[model samples]
Target: MAAKTKKAIVDVKKQFEKIAEQFQTFQILNEEGEVVNEAAMPDLTDDQLKELMRRMVYTRILDQRSISLNRQGRLGFYAPTAGQEASQIASHFALEKEDFVLPGYRDVPQLIWHGLPLYQAFLFSRGHFHGNQFPEDMNALSPQIIIGAQYVQTAGVALGIKKRGEKSVAITYTGDGGASQGDFYEGINFAGAFKAPAIFIVQNNRFAISTPVEKQSAARTIAQKAVAAGIPGIQVDGMDALAVYAAVREARERAVNGEGPTLIETLTFRYGPHTMAGDDPTRYRAKEEENEWEKKDPLVRFRKFLEAKGIWNEEEENKAIEQAKEDIKEAIKKADEYPKQKVTDLMNNMYETMPYNLQEQYEIYTEKESK
Candidate 1:
């Protein structure tokens, strides 16, 4: 008898690559500000479209002023938001007042729109206690600095919302690097298993500090990572505000409708270094590459789109820039009035009732402050 032909061996890596290819980056507007996907265009009113453009303009100015403050030693820690306005503000505009936001360090802009005081955000960068304090009515948490930890926390928050039968969703943001963390997988897995109303956003800005994302994962697309979690996943052009808003708005709708979680990957870029903490993008990123992304700037693209619709103009954009400048000036002044954070404040804030050991240390610091 002829030997049976061996079946073709499974090519796991190639199969995964094919799966990744299936997750196309969704786009409504192209790089030239032309509507490429007319069907995907959001049903936002003309006023809403103009407002989104205004906010994006404001955020660009905010990001510029923030970097200047960081260099002048007026701000403590800042992640430049220059190239991320569309990915940040537009997605934020899609949320309801009752939804919860668990943000990463780069997501202060979202928290601000979610009712966090601008002065408090300044204080947060300055390491002031009041900066971390959110108003009682605000449905948000202080931005998480421990990378992907917010993902796990968001899962818990969403689960709690589910248990309470509230029609609210919990959303979180983390960078491409954060997506590689063990907590990221655990959080998504837990949320998927429990059918929690959670939305996970991965801002794939191409780098995690100095490390390019390509070195972090073999997966071709970050959105495909959601497949393992058993949830819907999508990649959207982060440079298109309309696209981001539409995608997030739909995700929120599905979440509140009891459809469980969704993972969104925003294909974006950061114009400046990862942080104001001395790391420079110039070392690793090519100037040509930076210039290429500059041509697709979210602010520029959205501005053109709105201008074509006749709802936005350069004058209106300038007004938004001026308003952002004034607001930043006032916020920094307010932040200056906050008393400096103390070691004792850290100890006291850590627990509702201080542990005996911490209480002893708190007394020591208190005595020092008394002198």
Candidate 2:
């Protein structure tokens, strides 16, 4: 007879600790603007490198102008994107036009680059219905506001793409806080089980509003959570555009090749409050922490790398900034020219044939407007 075996007690916490140690933080550039991992650098051409830097700079300027507009009551429901340029833009830079983008509320910059016009983005911020309208060729959904909802939706979109025999991927983003939601797990697990082509990115910017990442979960890293779903997970230096681009490009390739989904945790930081709706970062985060993250600013890091290559300079950056300002000015003017949104507008767009109850309400609202 075989020797009787005794059950072994498993140390769950220690196992997780060891598991976390296996996932390293991927980086191509250091905080000092030096290439630390030259081997992992993306194969971007000189022009492409400069273009990445240019988009990051333009996005920074856009963030600044958006904050000003929010303060002046010209914009609504604004989420500041000052410190997430590399994580947002560079990953998007890796995607092709055929890939579908499912964005969170903070991902408007990516949507804009993906073909949504600046005026439409402004309108969306102001809660106008027309903002939902997109160009016929654009393959993106509106920025999701209900936190982790986009994660589940992205899984569906990816499944749809696979069923159609399309060689494209679906990508979505959420914050560190969003990783805590049940939908996040459901989305990744479903995609992994079915081998759906999807990319899930968690922009771990240290906080979910006021709660820090420490309070969110016990897992050592968000990326490691992908293991349970049978997919690869990676943690990338979000401040390094090259690293983000490389990681995303690899993930996209794997996805289209039927390797399923990837979970990317970008180690980045936000330099402002969660939103313009009366939150304060000082109450929760320290000034020293903010300063430390500022040292790793994506724009500064990428600009340094490009300057070293003789591809970017102050003059080029200034031109980009000025162009951003002019474009924002024109978009805001267009938004101002739009007819004021009304209750009737919302009801009219609810469906092709309104129900009896809805039609009655619509007529009542229409009569009130006429008066």
Candidate 3:
């Protein structure tokens, strides 16, 4: 029999608020673009800072262009990426050239950093199989569209790295809603148990499509989900690139040193609808909420920081923006040059030894192609 004396069962649900507060979204730069945490700031040269800002600008522009292309019917499907540039791009800067990255759909920017050319990403959204081919020797996988699947796959990749005695770590990303998935728990658990080198970043963008995160889980912070797995968990202000770079850089250090996986939760938001495939944020999000998050835009804050330091100005920024646009236009041209996908080739690519049913279908496709 259990003995209960002078004890009240803690209300775990209510306690979530406290837990969330304790983790406290880490930030170096405030919304006003001031360094609030001097100690937490990463050592960055002016050139390095400029480079970081440039990447952020590039990623933001890429997102805007892709969404426009989708809206204009030039692209088949696209996931909006307006508000989470700092979270993905900054963490990517923390990784070495050899690191393996398993990305979610929202992680295309990071994938570009990992060697998926800009045009390839566009081709991917347009449903071209050629987009699936990553650059040579880039230790990155295609984007995982099944919410939390990348977490478990990252665990496996991390284990593989460890088994090979490699110094590299595998990093993966997911959203707040993804943190509620079973695979998310399983992936972190396995990595923690085996001390596999993996970094899992949950970009808690406040909502999973139409549903808010509060309705997704009772947990206070997505980072704390790593607690039960016995790994370090942290929360960072996703809007602060410097802070994100610092957090992931340290986590990489720990992982390569035989330490287990670390879970980093980034508090972020998506300024646009979930996907351009036909969704409307106006249906659920209040205009006031949107305006509030807009104030925290990573690009705006970083540009402010650069201006204050005298390392960046509007002319320089405009040049970078213009170059990014031109580069994107070139990539799109290259993507268009790919021989339009042949249906018969598609069937042939689907099999090594084709089953009779599929082979029969392949024959039909071949017959159609010859017509």
Candidate 4:
């Protein structure tokens, strides 16, 4: 047997084992869409709540439409946003139009909220250069497919915002899986060090592409990871749109006020598999778990709240959904109207001055196409 170690006082902050269990998840709506505490809810007019719900419905429909498009061979590699409407869509409503956005792949919904056209989003998914073009007025970058890359890149954008003395912030998002990357910590730490005006959101969807949260992280809570960076960390109910919007709105205020970065960990669930064509969630999570989360559906709860206020009904919902679908259809048609992509576009845009080898490759491709 080894020598026994002496017992000593423990630092509360370092006790990752206890923190996850102790952190109270901030929530505004109950499972049935009733208010848990009316006083605690965010102040929103009845019209505002309806608009919010409309967007959530649009997001869900868009996800379904994108999947259908992919199956029809009209789109390419796509991430399903079915279960994350509240976290990604509602949080976006709190952002200033001028805020710089660097988003992860699943965050196309947010990019749309930031002024990216529906057709452009479709174009990007189809691997077109037009997809990368955002109207210059919209201060955002195209979605990053590389895991955890947006964290550091957004940090750089946030630094620029801070340096320019603008009253804006740079916001970015990642998933629980992305939280595992070293760039996650490095970016947050760098932002914290520089007091960069940034907001880093981690949508902790419980499964990192089939790996349960228990396996993805040993930390009690992902928000606690921010403790190391000397910034405020918050845990919000990602299933509650009101809660998400309130949390992000407050974080934006803090960032614009010259406060450093914030790391927000949303306790959410991704209802679908990792992607439309890849990763089967069935092997990792139980159907019972899915059923349980379905009860907490953000759309249902928010609709109930709106119904209570006499601002929404089933008929209105159907019309909004139909309108959203028609809008998507029109946008897809516009995207298809774009001329077919050329080999020249692929080789010319990669660099300001094409390297020697790339030039030769470009010439070879051009010659072959001509022949």
Best by lDDT: 2
Best by TM-score: 2
192-286, model 2: which lDDT tens digit per residue? Answer: 99999999999999999999999999888999999999999999999989999999999999999999999999999999899999999999999
Q: Of models 3 and 4, which has the larger lDDT? A: 3
Tens-place lDDT digits, model 1, residues 1-371: 99999876998878876896889999999998999999988899998888888888888888899999999999999999889989999999999999999999999999998998899999999888899889999999988999899999999999999999999999999999999999999999999999999999999999999889999998889899899999999999998998999999999999999999999999999999999999879999999999999999998898888888888887998899899999999999988887888898887787889888778888888999888
Q: State candidate 1's TM-score.
A: 0.95
User: RMSD per prediction, one decimal?
Assistant: 2.0, 2.8, 2.5, 2.4
lDDT (0-100) at residue 161 of candidate 2? Answer: 93
Candidate rank order under lDDT: 2, 1, 3, 4
Per-residue alpha-carbon lDDT of model 3 for 224-272, expressed as tens digits? 8877899999999999999999999999999999997999999999998
Model 4 weakest 10-residue run by lDDT: 14-23
Residue 217 lDDT, candidate 3, scale 0-100: 81
Whole-model lDDT values for every prediction: 0.92, 0.94, 0.89, 0.88
lDDT, candidate 4, 207-256, per-residue tens = 88878888887777899888889998999999989889988889999999
Clashing pairs in 3: none
